[model samples]
Target: MVLVSAVRDYISRMLQDISGMKVLILDSHTVSIVSVAYSQSELLQKEVFLVELVDSISKSRESMSHLKAVYFLAPTSENIQYLRRHLVAPRFGEYHLFFSNILKDTQIHILADSDEHEVVQQLQEFYADFVASDPYHFTLNMPSNHIYMLPAVVDHSNLQRFSDRVVDGIAAVFLALKRRPVIRYQRTSDIAKRIAQETAVSTVVYSK
Candidate 1:
């Protein structure tokens, strides 16, 4: 229940203060992040009338000035690009940007610069990046699950990306709880050890 409660609290905080009809914009990854902790009926109760993928949200050229956009997405380059396009020709009256994990300074700068229309009202990091399957079990839902089993030498770039994401997920879990944990991993697995060490560094960095 820890993971579920933490994610639910984050979602509640995001929606509770915002009034009027809202359109929730999620990425492919955040769909799982939200679905695990919330339901469509709960969103409707919060006055969220629409749920849409960031990539698909702009497919319609129609303006929706009555509905505000509440975007909860991972801070990825592709998602950033999609946001840039949306900002250029905004369909919603207001945007509340909430990233699932910590975002780079440059990424924030890029977003701020792109918002020429001043449609964006708020920018925040809520740290509900991983999928909570159960109270004691959570998953990053990594696409390259097989890559983690391979040696770091093979496809070094992808290996590093995988490790970084692992660290991010772990850091986000701790951040959501407002705690900094000393991460431990199995001694037999090099990947686990690497993830733990990186997570420690990331946790410290993000805590500040």
Candidate 2:
């Protein structure tokens, strides 16, 4: 199946069982995830009254206890931190956390520890990580992506950020496919080699 369809299926399944007015919460990355596969009208059709960013959602003290919250986000530290803060005093009645890839157990524990209000109902990993820009080609859209051209010592921070996103996207795709295929990288690209190394490590960990 296509990347869009994979993400759409994950979302459709997330919202299918719950029958009521809902709010869809997304991180910066996940906004693109849902936006590509689903539309504002489609969310409205599913009784999703609001679609807000996780960071933005925390800005208001207004309690939306009437709407169930379905959070779809990348399994990033920032998103986890946001959930920790929100769980301290939840605005939504029920929260269902759907991550885009494998979540660290520590991340789950952190969220669980903060959920004193008992608002979160479920936690799961759904592998729909890559942005499906098109059928034939998909860009990882790694921020600081240009850093791949520099040596590790020259742009360590930016290169790390770039590789993390690329590895995340590739793993997401492979996880979605449930495949273990051999991969190749451009031999000349510095970033490509680094990303390939990271991807290898990720595959080894996830494959086990």
Best by TM-score: 1
Model 1: residues >4 Å from true position, as ranges?
Answer: 186-189
Please give the range of 10 consecutive residues that has the lowest summed lDDT in model 1: 144-153
Relative to the true structure, candidate 1 has a C-alpha RMSD (angstroms) of 1.6
- For residues 86-148, write the lDDT of model 1, one tens digit per residue: 998998999999999888888898999999999999999978999999886899997658767
TM values, all candidates? 0.94, 0.90
Best by lDDT: 1
Roughly what TM-score does model 2 have, to 2 decimal places? 0.90
lDDT of 2 by residue, 1-208 (tens): 3766777788898888878999999887878878878888988888888889999987888988999999998899999998999899898889999998888899989999999989889998887787777654555656655645755446577557766878888977777667765778889777788778888778777877
The C-alpha stretches of model 2 lying farther than 4 A from their native spots are: 151-153, 188-190
Q: How many pairs collide in each candidate, listed in order?
A: 1, 0
Q: List the residue pairs that clash in candidate 2.
A: none
Error of 1 at 8 (Å): 0.4
How accurate locally, in lDDT, is each candidate?
A: 0.90, 0.82
